[model samples]
Target chain A: MSVLAFIDQSEGQVKKGAYEALSYAVKLASQLGTTAEAVVLGKLTDDIAALGKYGVKKIYHVADEQLNHLDAQVFADVIAQVARAAGAKIIVLSNNSDGKAIAPGLSVKLKAGLVSGAVALPDTGNGFTVKKSVFSGKAFAHVAIKTDIKIIALNPNSFSITEAGGGNAEVSAFAAAVNTPKVKVTAVNKVKGDVPLGEAEVVVSGGRGLKGPENWGMIEELAKLLGAATACSRPVADTHWRPHHEHVGQTGLAIAPNLYIAIGISGAIQHLAGVNRSKTIVVINKDPEAPFFKAADYGIVGDAFEVVPGIIEEVKKLKGVA
Target chain B: MKILVCISKSPDTTAKIAFTDNNTKFATDGVQWIINPYDEWYALVKAIEIKEKDPSAVIHLVTVGGADVEPVIRKALALGGDEAIRINADTPDSYYVACQIAETAKQGSYDLVLAGKETIDHNSASIGGMLAELLELPYVSLATKLELNGNTVLITREIEGGEESCEVNTPVVVSCQKGMAEARIPNMRGIMAARTKPLKVVEPVAADSFTGIVSFELPPAKAGVKLIPADNPAELVRVLHEEAKVI
Candidate 1:
């Protein structure tokens, strides 16, 4: 009985959340007195064996090019088969879009009890209970999975990543019958950018206070300097100050990163509902009483035009750039 | 196109969160219940848009809650849903709720299932995924934009670091969030039409529950905001490093 983690990949590269999930699965496996193993569903350019540094002992790779693009039904069926083959009592996945899409189906297929958005390690003294945020991060509930097979989707950045001396994991190819999805892709729309928000450890988000689309360059600059993704408040996107794709809120994207920097945002309750799970928050605004400051771990009361440039400069300095 | 839009009754977004009975359950007293905002803003609006594109399209509002939630169901009907179904039971768990919904969807033979990414009350974003699984349908969550052409549905969803676009066949499940569309209020004509619309209540089929919530509690109160002098931004950084240890 081992812990099985699904390592998500895109375009033959491992996604950042996969690393976080691997780290988390390692801890969960240790607690369960078992080993951690990974299951990859697509062709990957990255060295799968080197993932052993994340503490997984073995990797099961399904290197079919057809599996590259996520087809939830096919992916879930294949993952359920892999979980059964590996004797994974506990299956872990990163609670991002793809995981959310497939987990419930996989759970039902495997008759496994699932806990999504798990924030902490399970309490195993009595029954196997995991804690998860409820009410949009306003509360928490301890859910005890009664099924023999259990599934957990860990929130991004909830667990710290630790690397140690590694074993080059043994990799074996597994083949399963694939189901062709009824949905066929006629065209692909890719948002060209340096980093995707879901993969960024650092994120810089702007709000209405940025004023207009033209001023967005500074936010982007800061994000580029920190190697982070750029995001926006709902109003900013609604007003077309930023693309709708960049919006984040209760009704938008829910992101939890290692460091989240909010600029010119008032921290509306709705907006806070989405990102309060971030490990560390920094707010920059000229308004001293912006609601975002209350939740921010660090605050700078200055105009974005002035403060954001300062931040960009500081990051460059930290990186040993002139 | 047939769209099944799922709505849940949750406390208004600004309500102060509190628990009852030694923190075992959420306190409902004096709390104003509203349509789960995400559903109101995203799912319902998108459904309305689909109906607009095809006047012959049917939109049904579905909920799994006690009878007290009927008014919300009627409100959804007013907001352009052609009919409503209330599964008469408390949504005890994600599994139970998904089973009830999947059973209803199967019987109705709906072409599409729409829901909010998560209910603001429990914040468990599992029902859509669970229902999709139970029905053996494709599922997408946090969809900001959706377009349907022939039998294929194109959806754009928000992910952690970026957005993903996928094309899936009809009979798929989608959970909506902010960018799907702006919420629309019922005009007088729609409001009047809703009173005449049928709202059918049915008993939920029994299903095995694999998990239970032991208790619920509010997050610890945030510490009082610490203020640093506006002129001393450098000192604020110092406090972040030494006091908050967040830098």
Candidate 2:
């Protein structure tokens, strides 16, 4: 009878993507003629009641320290119980790492129709259908969930956030049976970067054209000035020019940043598969026939050493940085 | 050691996407299908590597599809799987597919189950988790690196901004991505041997699907590239700031 949004938090802080999911649920609840509620695991540093501005009427907090690290089965079990208790006909989540792992297990547990990587709002005029990106953002699929309960994992940066005025949610503690983890986390290795690629608005990606790893100073400078994430093509990752996490291609992380700048990387179809969703693409390759130029919103055919520094200077001037 | 690898075929990465029958079905007129990259390049490769290291290890391939999927299964065998199993059914629902695989694995008693993180076609990325639930086994999604030991495995999976290393006992399910293993092409000898390998066809278990596709549509095509002359780097930045408002 209600909509529930799983507002994922990390290190006791609500992520930016969760705000989009919460806001998305708020709109979905209004359309369904019901109120929206939110669920979070572990204690949070952010004030839970302040989330009411996103249209959540109640906040269900499961304060479990063990829940800090994401365990897919444990989360799925706990969320399924919350959904059943709240009568959540529609469950909303960000199509993120946690969401991707937990939503599928949850779908089986709740027998709910799940649509992940949803790009837009559902079209409910005739029947409930959610539009999602398929073929790695090459196409769209309109899926109709026939089950009584539904789950949606919305893609991050696809929807804008909306806030409601003078709204406050009541926070209450909820208890659910926790399961013993089947997998044990032995070590955590953090990838150090200026910005987390998943949440970055702008991304500057390089390919093998940078020649070698030592010549990456310009790309880093540009990325630092723009506050953008740094990515690389698959070959670069394979050749050890960059870490595997920074590789952005069909076989790598699929990102939809607002602006994606590709340098020296031929826009191979495989490479484009992961980044084609970027709002704007700028290609910097000396090869006029490089495949990436065809998909770029803007193209510059020149030497990376020459063109990148000039662009960096302009960006620095624009930022008024000494 | 026993390993079960799930393989699926999908359109080539560069294939143009189109839908027919009012978007109810995918267009397959001229599309060239290949084993999903994750399956071929990571899950299957890692399985074969383990088999090569331990000659006693057995690797099996499974797929749930019609006769058209046999060629793909044969290809998996060509890559050195001991045998292959085809569940005679076709459904896009990941849970239904997982149920069939779970029932098969329950009987086979596989020590490890590996599948692509997701197929390039539907991109569901759900079967591994669902299968784990059905079989009551531990599950790991998007495992980039896996190292097998006596009865336990060390796993590395990508998190939001880092890598997470996990340890799980045998009878675990893992959906693999890149960094697990390099894809190996089938040699002439392997291809010849694959033609005679055992391919067992089994009837699928009854599993109901929860979702259905209403239709399919392609995204609006790009307007093509707007070329900015190489000499005018400043102008490109100006446009990015003024027109695109991206800066």
Candidate 3:
């Protein structure tokens, strides 16, 4: 029996979240006294063998070019078949977009218990129980999986990825037949940014207090200087001050970064629900009584225009960029 | 054309969250319930917009809850859904809910199935995908945009840093997010029409839940903030760089 990691990729490149899932599964496999194996669908640009650093003992590569584009049904079908063939007792996937689209289907198809948004490693001492974020990060829930097979969709950035120095793993060709996709790809529109929000270690976000979208240069400057991603509150996205993808709130993307800095955001409960998982939170707002200040690890009560300039100058100095 | 939109109720965003019974039950006192924003603003409105464009289309709203959830259903009907189905069961488990919906959709022969990406209360974004799996159909999750032309449906969804469009045939399931459509408010005519619109309450189908909640926990409170004076904003940055080492 093995713990199977479903490593997600886009355009043949592995996503950062997949590394976290791989590392997480490896640890779980150790605890369960089983080996960790991984299955990758579609093409891979990187050497699959190198992922052994994460402690995966074996890698299964489907190498199907047609599997590059995602169709949840087709993807789930192949992954389920791989799980059955591999005798996997637990399947691990990152709770990112790809995992979100496919994990639930796989659970239903395999009759496995699924725990999405898993934050911590499971506690197997008593019975298998996984801790997960519920109510949009407002609370955590421990769910006990009673099924023989368990499926966990680890939240992106929730688990730290560990590397095993100079390890090697065996890679075998998986000859699983690819199903003809019912979903047809039309066009792809990618957000033009260097750091994807889901994988960013630090995030600098802005809100309506910035006045207008035109004044977003300061927010971008801080994010760029820190090599962090940029995000905004829901109202900013709703008003088209920023792209919808950058919106971080209960209804938007839930992010868990090492550091999350909010500028001009009032820290509405809905907005905080998406970002409260950050290891540290900083709030800069003119209102001292802003609700966000309560949740912030560090807070500066001042105008964003006045405070952000100082932060930008300091970050640039620290980075020696200018 | 038939479109079934799944509507869900959740505590108002500003409601204070607390637990009862040794952190096993969500406290309801002083909480205000509303239609989950994702369901009302995206999935339901998108379905309404589609129905308005094509007069031949019928929009049906479904929810799994008791009679207390009727107002939300009527409100959905008021927003132009032709009918509503209330599955009289309230087990917050996603798999059981998905099974109930799958049975209902199969009986109705729905051409398209739609739901919010997730419910705010549970944040379990599983129902749509599970429904598709149970019904043996294709599912597109977190679709920001959906367009139906005849039997073919076009969907635009977020994937990592990019957005991709896909085309699928009829009998497709889609979980909607923002950018699908704007939120709608019921007009006087629509409100009156909703009073008489059909709301069929059916008993839930039996489905075993494989997961049980052990307990609920609130995240630890933040260590009170270290307030940096407005004149010295650099202090905050320095602390982040040195103390937190996050920069």
Q: For each candidate, how many residue pairs have backbone atoms clashing (under 3 Å)?
A: 10, 1, 0
Q: Weakest 10 consecutive residues, lDDT, candidate 3 chain B?
A: B90-99
lDDT of 2 at B184: 83
Q: Kindly list the per-residue Cα lDDT of model 1 for residues A109-132, writing each as its tens digit.
A: 888899988888988889999898
Question: Tens digit of lDDT per residue, candidate 2, span B78-170?
Answer: 888999999999876887898899888988999999999988878778888888878867788889999988898999997777778999999
Query: Candidate order by TM-score, highest to lowest?
Result: 3, 2, 1
TM-score of each: 0.94, 0.97, 0.98
Cα lDDT computed for each candidate against the true fold: 0.82, 0.88, 0.91
Q: lDDT by residue for model 1 over B1-247, one digit each (tens)?
A: 8899989998887777788888778888888888998888899989999989999899988999998998888878888888999999877678888999998899889889999988886777888888888998888877889999898889887654456777887889998987888867889998899999999999999988888787776666556455554555556545544665544
The native-contact fractions of the candidates, in order shown, are: 0.54, 0.73, 0.84
lDDT of each residue in A1-322, candidate 2, tens digit only: 9999998976677877899899999899888789999999877899889999887889888888777767788888889988899989999998877787788888888988888889888987877899988898888899988889999999888888898763779987888888877788888776565687877899999999999999888988999999998999999999989988899878888899999999999888889989989999999999999998878898898988899999998898899998
The prediction achieving the highest lDDT against the true structure is 3
Q: In candidate 2, which residue ranges exceed 4 Å CA deviation?
A: none
Model 1 TM-score on a 0 to 1 scale: 0.94
lDDT of 3 by residue, B1-247 (tens): 9999998888988888899999999999989888888889999999889888999998999999999999888988898888999999976578888998888999989999999999887787999999999988999998999998889999999878878999999999999998899877889999999999999999998898878889999999887998999888678878998999998
Residue B179 error for model 3, in Å? 0.6
Assess candidate 3 and give its TM-score to the true structure. 0.98
Q: Is the docking of candidate 2 incorrect, acceptable, medium or high quality?
A: medium
